[model samples]
Target: MSKESRKFHVPDALANLYDFANTLDLRHFTHHGIQHQQADELHNLAALGEWMRQHGLIERAAAPSQKTFEAALRLRAAVRDYLKCEPAERHRKPAVIGPLNAAMEAFALRVATIGKDGFALRPVTSDAQAGLSAIVAELYDAASAGTLGRLKMCAADECQRVFFDRSKPGTRRWCQSTLCGNREKTRTYRERHRHDPASEV
Candidate 1:
């Protein structure tokens, strides 16, 4: 795969890692239908660190230790959870996402001063704070513009994960078809066949 595609495409290692960290669902790591909640946080964090390493977001640190992975997971979970809230909610309760955006902007600015990573990294600086600030503003703009309506909850009864559905028909209901859709379809097919024997042949 092309390097950029490999780096950012959803379901790739990095994207999977990002998704895992951003959304905490136990099913991603389960084996034999048993959930492993204990490692959920740690796995999420480790995935982010791996994503950063692959994308050159942060300097490559050593392979994350178990403790480091858990800490990163906790830290990222806090940031992601905070970001998921409405801005008004954030204002009423200052929390990690606010500070993280601040810190990331600062880091972006610091990198910009060095003329190193280009505009992608420029969002971290003071001048770019306006742009960074736009992200928060745009959240409201998007809400006002009806853009937020594109957000959807996965159709799987047991999985309520949220996603932005960019499908042309806008009819997508599951986070992934191979995973949830197939399972539901298979169960339905069996149920119909069991009740209507003529269709089974």
Candidate 2:
């Protein structure tokens, strides 16, 4: 962690706190995320810091250390496991929150209200670890409040990237429609063709 990246800055209020919980976009060898998280990107602390900043987990001046980076990997693994559960199971007492709670406790956090209907979680210290924890805390708050409408894993078993369902009808089944969605659809088509007697090779 460098002072140049964490010494002075104001937290951006416009960022969606729940969004930070999705910092982990694990690589499945098929495609990259809206923010790439390839092995190289994740292994490098500086690149991890840059990704966090873009995702509103940390301010531009907030640098991440090796500890912060390692903690983040742990948190993401916990989250990814949690997302692998069925939706109904998740709504119940799935065994994933234990790790989530542990991850949330990594940093000190306080809820500060800006107005009658606006309050945000802030870290007690300027450390990048605090930023990571605060992001998880904010997500926990959102999930408990029922604001995280439809967080889901991709239907493609091999490409199990978790994503927030942003559809009007809430029918999104793939992490990315253009990529995984299309691939699955093409596979289905091939399967149908293989079964068709008239079109059989």
Candidate 3:
């Protein structure tokens, strides 16, 4: 599968479900140039719905709801805002978390059968935003424990991609260094040298 399609699988090291919410790519430098989910297809609504299921964000059996889809998209933006803020600053958003709480309450936990590692907390939720909520809870849990310090939005002012920092030092500063980071650096370099006398012939 393509890399965008492959983002649904959450690694054990990166266990937050909120990672799935912000699927839109906003790296484009111009207005109205952003895309939803970055589908390989033309990114029609139907394609977006199909993509959601393929990534396991929405269940396969349930017909996706329009309300739910809008909420999910809004929730994604709210999540981005929450993540970008400092821990102390996160409390300033009741509007951002209202949907999160709604989604969280819609879902429940079920006890699964025995395993070598004993019982685990498995989420049980149906169609609509319940699935979205289940993942939001995970992000909150991770953030509360301070383990999500590595989760970050790209440092580049124009890039809206969220990235997980797996660096040994937990100091990763860009979503993708070759893309937004390099672009920003190049812009800065040109600005710095634009005023230099030696550059002007």
Candidate 4:
């Protein structure tokens, strides 16, 4: 669990998926005279391996190959694309779901007995790809538990950051109303009055 995940209060079950989906920060909006620089945590195989190890998804010595790195990038992109859609439309949108499903084919999980009566999803492999399967397992488990719907990408085009919607109505469009939401609202208000004669004076 990373600091960002904990700060956002993302549930433990979905933390990995949340973090993985947010590997690429698309927030390019300026705030308080500062521009938010976009960054991708998984910029390369070494970075991916470091991230996997940091998240305890893989062993410290486990290194991801170039192929695995490419697959991981695809998975991240597919996840972000899927999250960009409305929760209700996520399954219905083939343009998004197809790529996501295709990217997820590289990872696999299996049901395993946890304790007395509990069962949990475990990665089927022990190699570097297993770390990715762990992420897939999180997605599957969250979806089965219905918490997956709460995970969404910010509606702001400038800030396509993935966030967990904690609203009771679950209809939040922006990651933070005080920031992205307000910026959009302000922009819309300006556009609406842009051609108004009242402002011409």
Q: What is the model-wide C-alpha lDDT for candidate 2?
A: 0.63
TM-score of each: 0.38, 0.66, 0.65, 0.97
The better candidate by TM-score, 2 or 3, is 2
Error of 4 at 133 (Å): 0.6
By summed lDDT, the worst window of 10 consecutive residues in model 3 runs over: 35-44
Instruction: List candidate 3 stretches off by more than 4 Å.
Output: 1-10, 13-19, 29-48, 57-59, 86-125, 196-201
Residue 12's lDDT within candidate 2 is: 30
Which portions of model 2 show Cα errors greater than 4 Å? 1-40, 54-62, 192-201
Better of 3 and 4 by lDDT: 4
Instruction: Pull out the clashing pairs in model 1.
Output: 105-124, 108-124, 109-124, 109-125
lDDT of 1 by residue, 72-173 (tens): 445445444544444345546556556655533322222233346532223332331222222333333445655544444466655545455557765676
Candidate with maximal TM-score:
4
Task: State the TM-score for model 4.
Answer: 0.97
Between prediction 1 and prediction 4, the one with superior lDDT is 4
Q: How many backbone clashes does candidate 4 have?
A: 0
Ordered by TM-score, highest first, the candidates read 4, 2, 3, 1
- Each prediction's whole-model lDDT (CA): 0.46, 0.63, 0.59, 0.92
Order by lDDT, highest first: 4, 2, 3, 1
Point out the worst 10-residue segment of candidate 1 by lDDT: 125-134
